[model samples]
Target: MARFQTPLRYPGGKQRLAPFITEILEHNDAVGWGYAEPYAGGAGIAIELLLGGTVDHIYLNDSSRHIYAFWKAILTDTEAFCRRVSRASLTLDSWQKHREVVRHPGDHDILDLGFSTFFLNRCNRSGILTAGVIGGLNQVGRWRIDARFPRNELIKRIETIATKKRRITVTNLDAEAFMRDRVNKLPPSTLTYCDPPYYARAKRLYLNVYTPDDHVRLAKFIQSKLRRAWLVSYDSHAAISELYRKRRQFQYSIQYSAIQAYEGTECFIFSDSLKIPRDSALPYIAQALRQPA
Candidate 1:
């Protein structure tokens, strides 16, 4: 698969991990099956897997209003969304303008807010909406603000993704609510990918920051409540390691971005029923987090 089938450049996005995920789906004979992501930040893996024909249908949900609006508009109002993207002004001035639109999205329609969010995500550092431009405000840095916001390519991605509107289900729902209301209804053969906010760095990275207790609650729900075959990814942290210490888990490092790129450790926990692959794909050398005691 071509690297980065999605338009957005999300920090810690799992576009690189698509191959490993594909291998897992293949190992389990889950190709052409239903796929889901409850905390669908950028939906990198979901987008690649579905578009590459690894899965026939995919479900994506995010609690963030702007994220939900963005996905909704992209699928439902494809032409208008692409037009908005095509016509976007790529400058520090336009970045500030879009920032305001993103901050006060209630005043505008979903499509407008969605496009503004897209604009900021592309123009800003690490695709973080709250972060600043790709280069400094003076535009004297190595890259300009428009360096990443390639209008034509991004528009093509939007249009292409919109083509699969029928096969994609997008929603604005809490992860717990999504599991209860949406995922519970999918076929037993479905494989759900749960890439939740990194507990160690979520406060700085996401608007919907999770408390320590919230992490515990999510762990309980995933271990006890989620009935279908599911896999979860999280930045490695002691708390998270403790939470899934007894489950089937693997450890590896990924290139994560905050203000800059850094090698960050990550862990993947699989449900009890699934078979762990004998080895992980390249670029992600898997080591056992710990064998279940």
Candidate 2:
């Protein structure tokens, strides 16, 4: 049987890269180690690792309050969370209502906030929370509204995740703060996977934009934990490439169909302690340890 899919459709989710991620985790001996995902967007790869028994425990963290609230509800009250999402109506009206509340959810109840996040994410085109409308004005009917929002499938997925016996800790904190507060306390056996927003598209794709300086800060923090951390980002930015010039890097292309089909280069930066086996699924690119002249 196929591994349970992520309940939400995240724009940059690594669902297709699950096999390669599993291969990398296996290569680095992740079976008994704790797995930490600081930027856990849709958490597709993390869920896969947990379900495949690749890790002993998983720590999921996200800076987005709504996203974090949704995950927190899932971990604390899976049935109620699933019920809230399952019963949500997938209509333009419903989408707008939820979007309004998610935009300012300070006064909303926890379950409402969770449902709002879940609705906006799944109902919005391309799973972009900020993108308004269930289907963009020009792209109405492009998404089979009812068919795409499969309540039963989502509930099943949530149930599967909820039943996993392995420990799961969900936190709402800035990535750096989370690392400082929790990561330092964990054993070196912990393997952290950082999938921050792409530097070039952060402002367009995410609410909390990662500026060049933020990228530098993240790089510095990851460098401190390089012995057990792995970072992924688009290979288009020069500053990012320069930041990890001395580290081991792997480049691969990810192809997906949105409004149109597109393929882009993705880079994985890792410490010298991690090795990419020759037999791994990713098409190996030369290690990126030198800056472009």
Candidate 3:
């Protein structure tokens, strides 16, 4: 029932926003056009669009080599990756070993580290590579180490994605480089949706965090360098509002869970090439429904 295309359980993933993005793609006459994500950590939204047949192609890029290798493995080494997933031991000891691999990911091969990244992600709380394991070491909590990882179901999702490998492009590049080198080369109809590292707890939550200056540079570059249709999503941080104060913007909220107040609210800024429905207020996309004209 869920559009569970991605195996990675990313914190603050935009799964609920897939419908809104679909609206953006269709409204721009860009349906079946190229879609891209520069900070493709879990790439939940991109995978949903691709698997749901809303986008003809999806570009997924991440600056972290481990993250990139994880996606690269999914697309290129699908069978082996699925095999590893099917047989991965979900014990805390196994998690510890995979954690070591993630720590010194440089020592592992592309596929090995990729699987390890996936392993640690699924086993860790919130899918954060560096976070502690679920249910704690005692394993006496409400959940356990294997609570999130239904290996059988995970393989199905991975295999389903692999069937469309030719339609998915995976890259390892910094956000700025990806924007300039890869996305800019795509067709003009391509629409890139950027979810940069959120504003708060980013340093602790992500492998890479951007400085205030980096965020400013990104905003400037998105406004100036890129000509294709694009949009950026950031937490409703006051600084972000000021950064994109001149651009077309709106407040967005996820209606799925009332408990996750941490990442429930966001501010979206779009390029002048695209239009946000004037009648639509907060929380733009719901259930892949088309927005108002």
Candidate 4:
């Protein structure tokens, strides 16, 4: 019997407390259910679901092409990816080379280049391999990855996970389109875990903007479609609450300190509608929410 230990390669990934996400699954007995993620930034939750054997199949979607390519590479290529990352120097010139490869990488080396680029992106400062511009506190505003980062270990872990590729599906599309299609395509046992883009007042490089209206539309869409599913993770503003106000669900604000920005208690929203049985853990969810900030 094999196990999964590799963490998701993103800045705000929930690897630190995968238990919170896992608790939701364990309580619901969600294993073997179809796991769908609308915003598959690093596939952190999705990968955890896969490794936990909670989901027989996964449907992952992200609006970013670069992210999608990275997923594909990890699933299909490991050794070449390691070599590329090992050879990539994190200087300004090397970063530009990475960006170029990301922009127009040919099919001959899709898997290796994709994974290498994504690895460098995460290993780099700010978790983006865009440019060498350093800014902000905690270096949240720079792209830096030393050549000595653990590229070999990443390759080994990715290779191990790639062996179980029969049960995963990856897509690059907007969050709404993936949900719309799933409504008509999937069975009733599927579960969705949404961690939408943050709605805070800040600026960063993202593929697109998910406005307050977008959040409302997605919440409504999730409620109307899936017969037996739950949405977990952060919500943007009060838009998610307003969308789910009609339906009774447990909502919580988890305080998390961002390592990149040294910011504390960035209130993240968790909206869930899993008809949980009378259990001991449910009260704590509310208790944590009500405790003064």
| Reference-based lDDT, each prediction | 0.85, 0.74, 0.83, 0.60
Residue-level lDDT tens digits of model 2 in 64-116: 88888887777777888887767777666777788888989797876778878
Could you give the candidate ranking by lDDT, starting with the highest?
1, 3, 2, 4
Q: Is candidate 1 or candidate 2 better by lDDT?
A: 1
Rank ordering of all candidates by TM-score, starting from the highest: 1, 3, 2, 4
lDDT digits (tens) for residues 1-293 of candidate 3: 44567888877777767777877777777789999999988899899999899999999999998999898998889989998988888898998888899999789888999999999888887788888898888887888999988988899888888999999898888888999998898888799999998786577678889889989999999988977898999877889998888887766565332114453567788898897644332234431124321
Q: After superposition, which runs of candidate 2 have C-alpha atoms over 4 Å from their true positions?
A: 1-4, 136-144, 225-227, 282-293
Which of 2 and 4 is the better model by TM-score? 2
After superposing candidate 1, which stretches have Cα over 4 Å from the reference?
A: 286-293
What is the number of backbone collisions in each predicted candidate, taken in the order shown? 0, 0, 0, 3
Per-candidate TM equals: 0.94, 0.89, 0.92, 0.76
Which is better, 1 or 4, measured by TM-score?
A: 1
| Selected candidate, larger TM-score, 3 vs 4 | 3
- Cα displacement (Å) at residue 78, model 3: 1.1
Q: Which residue pairs clash in candidate 3?
A: none
TM-score, candidate 4, is: 0.76
Question: What does candidate 2 score on TM?
Answer: 0.89
Residue-level lDDT of model 1, residues 1-293, one tens digit each, is 23587877778888788888888898898889899999998999999998999999999999988898899989999999998888877877888888898999778888988888888888888788998788788888789888887788888888889999999999999999999888988999888899988888877677678889988999999898888999999988888989988897777876676677789988889998777677665645544422332
Tens digit per residue, CA lDDT, model 4, 23-117? 66677776577878878777766776677776788777887767777777776665666576567554556555666676665642656456546
